[model samples]
Target: MTSTYDQLVEIVTKLHNPPADLIRPDVTFAQLDVDSLTLVEISLRIEGDLGIRIEDNELEEDLTLAATTQLIDAKLAQ
Candidate 1:
């Protein structure tokens, strides 16, 4: 099974099409030039694809992919 981080990377890639090298765990969405609209879209995709609802306000461009994965994992645990 694909991990949450891998799922998130796929979501971001499908939405933003960022370079593969830049999709590392340490890279923030801001670094990939993801805007507010794209972030909202990403959140929607996450909900649909992962069955986890991430509030729009909870997603910050400063959040790294790893951090987002942790957030989703925490939510799933709940």
Candidate 2:
């Protein structure tokens, strides 16, 4: 069974549209070179895809793939 984190990563990867190697657990959104609009869109997509509403304030400047997965896992567990 795929773990929630893995599933989250999959969704993020799809939303990010980065190269296969470019998407990694520790890779920050800044490292992805994504603009604020793209980041906001990604958050919205995650909320829609996961059925979890992520507050805008929850998105920190150091957002990373691993951190995103963790956030989703936490929201789902709530």
Candidate 3:
């Protein structure tokens, strides 16, 4: 779980050019410059890393940092 969180942090950090100390669980995709296309790439990467495909419909704006971590955790559990 902690490792997944770390992975998400790394992804978000790369997507956004924010300061290292600015990263946090409350950040949203919009704040990180993650548009639809970037989201797709992130989804693909997550699928590759987790070995599970997430449906497009499953991708929601509500899945910000904390929400995304929870969603990934749930999918891996299933």
Instruction: For each of the candidates, give the backbone clash count.
Output: 0, 0, 0
Quality of model 2 by C-alpha lDDT: 0.76
State which candidate, 1 or 2, has the greater lDDT. Answer: 1
Instruction: Please give the lDDT score for candidate 1.
Output: 0.94
lDDT of 3 by residue, 1-78 (tens): 457778877766665455766567887677665677777777887887778777777765546788788888888899
**Residue-level lDDT tens digits of model 2 in 31-76:** 8776677777777887887789878777654788788788888888
lDDT scores of the candidates, listed in order = 0.94, 0.76, 0.73
lDDT of 1 by residue, 1-78 (tens): 999998999899999999887879999999999999999999999999988899988999999999999999999999
lDDT of 3 at 49: 72
RMSD of 3: 2.3
Model 3 residue pairs with clashes: none
Q: Pick the candidate with the highest TM-score.
A: 1
User: What would the C-alpha RMSD of candidate 2 be, to one decimal place?
Assistant: 1.9
TM-score of structure candidate 1: 0.97
